[model samples]
Target: MLGFINGFLRRRQRERLRVAEFSSYWLEILKTNVPLFNRLHSADQEELRWRVQVFLAEKQFEGCGGLTITDEMTVTIAGHACLLLLHRETDFYPELYSILVYPSSFLVPVKRDFDDAPGIVHEGVDVLCGEAWPTGAIVLSWDEVCQAFSDDRDGTNVTLHEFAHLLDMEGGEADGTPILQDHEHYREWAKVFETEFTHLRRARRRGRLTVLDEYGAEHPAEFFAVATEAFFENSSVMKQQHPALYGELKGYYQQDPIMWLSRSDPVK
Candidate 1:
């Protein structure tokens, strides 16, 4: 009973936030920084705006490494992150609460055991532009976020990449699979992703240029994130090169970005 009450109250709060007055300044920031925003249809653009409003209202943003958070930064990041939520029944990344932003790439300590070594573990720091924590925070580099949003077609979006991890983590662990809409869809999803994942690994081994980046071959979770970047940013080429993969993403996301691109006016 208490759980239901809490859920209802949260929904009411979010409904108010969704209909709250959105600042023209934030809208302009999205217009100027997020190229994908200009490509969306009018209806989708409005949906995105509502999602962003709720997103910014519910989530916390903090600056790190001598950086200061601003409306422009929050709006742009929320705009891109909410792109993943469009046209879907979402909890707005229920596990995520805080977003930590850095001015540029940051180094994170890493520790991993060699697959063949029994007791030896290697420890090091990795240079990362973004990361999604299972502990309820997503970290991003502000510069990389701007770069990805500026190009909007290079299939390299740190924001999308990390947020994709968050989506995968919603399934309880990040193994490349996200919570699907139906129980039966999991069978098809597994088949399609397995086939494509194998294809990408082979293509990387052969040093062949592919629409999905080679980095996707690293792991299933990374592949999902990379594929998401390509889904929104390089939709046309992805549709052409990996039709099955594109179809699954299209169905999962419930948005055809290619159609959006084809039907929309030139991006400003």
Candidate 2:
């Protein structure tokens, strides 16, 4: 009787968590906001909306610089950030405690914080974008962040970059590695990343045009960031040009964005 009672309590707790995670506020946000952007498939968009609802519930966001954080701000950030976890078995971002949002461009004083365990010399990233830290905070500028969803096609999204940083940190280290279900997955990840990484480096050197930009060659770390941008924006083009790389990304992200494109897509 005692053992049965313990099992019942555990099961009840899990059920409650599921209900809380997929709560009413989250469902409403998704129902309204997701259809605005046709970039995601109905399924992927639904997944993102659900994940964001759950993420906002779990994380803490502090509004700074006299900006009052509202429900819109919370939902916007959560929706995009949750896209990063749509395919993962676990949305393992518990290491992040707080999110700091500035109304516009904010200067980050330069400093180096090196992690000897990973031989990573963390340089203080400056300028007008976003930054994510392993087990640290993710920072965003709300002013620049809105462009990520603009109907006009641009090659950059600061939120996506920082969020990509969060995704990369999932392996408990940020050396361009994220969670993979198997050793076989790592072998493929390494090979495709190295080859495409070298291609981007060569293109940048020779002043030639390429799909994967020069920013990718900055480091293996930056490669992950740039690749993520390409993954969401120009997926079909990337797939056509780099079949093997596309295949790996499809597996890693667990979303085949190429299928999201339609015959009527004028940009394609």
Candidate 3:
């Protein structure tokens, strides 16, 4: 009875949000800041707007480092984050409850324990553009967010990178593999990803330029995020250079950016 009541309430809330007014100003922000928005077909664009509406209503945004949250900031962030949900069953990033934005790159303190030497720990500080926490929070550099979306071909979006981590965590951990549609898919996923990940590491070590960022070589989790950035932003190059990897992502995302780009007016 409790589960049924919650389900009904959720449906009612989504119905209301779906019919609410969508501002023209928010559309303008997408046009100006998020280059990928212009490439989406009209139907996909509408679906994205609907999802963003629900997302904004559910998630909390907090400004940090003397920054003030604005309609532009939240809307733009929501727009990019929702792109990951297009054409998929989504819970609007179920584990994410808050977004904390900073004015620019911020420092995070870190502690590392040595494995070989007992009782030895090292503390350090690292600058980050974005981070997703297991505790239902995401920290981002606002300036980096804007800059990343400004160039859709760069294959380096802080918003997408961080949000991908949320999806990975939905199954209880960030293991570079997300829950797929079927149990059988895991075998193919593992095999293809391992091969491609090895290829990336080799390319990085040999100083060869590849479509995926070398940072992806850091871990399977990071590889998934970096591959996602490339899948959407650098679709054509990735499809050509890494056809198998592209196939895996294309199957997962269910949107062909190359096709979208082909039909849309040329991106300036």
Stretches of candidate 1 exceeding 4 Å from the true structure = 115-117, 264-268
Write model 3 residue lDDT over 1-268, tens digit each, in one string. 9988987887789889877888999988877877888888788888888998999988999999999999999999999899999999878887889999999999999988889987998999999999999999999999999899878898899999999888888877898998787789889989999999999999999999899999999999999999999999999998999898899888887888878667657332
lDDT of 2 at 39: 58
Query: How does model 2 score by TM-score?
Result: 0.79
Q: In model 3, where do residues sit more than 4 Å from their true spots?
A: 1-3, 114-119, 264-268
TM-score of each: 0.96, 0.79, 0.95
True-vs-predicted CA distance for residue 76, candidate 1, Å: 0.8
lDDT of 2 by residue, 1-268 (tens): 9978976875565345544545466555544443223456656655665566567656888877777787766777777677667768874375777788888877887767556646555667577557787766888888877666553134456676788878788776776777787887898899888998888888889998766767888888788887877776777677887888778877887877666666344220
Query: Which candidate tops TM-score?
Result: 1
Evaluate model 3: give its TM-score.
0.95
Sorted by TM-score (best first), the order is 1, 3, 2
Best lDDT goes to which candidate?
A: 1
Model 1 residue 7 CA deviation in Å: 1.8
**Residue 202 accuracy (lDDT) in model 1:** 98
lDDT of model 1, residue 7: 93
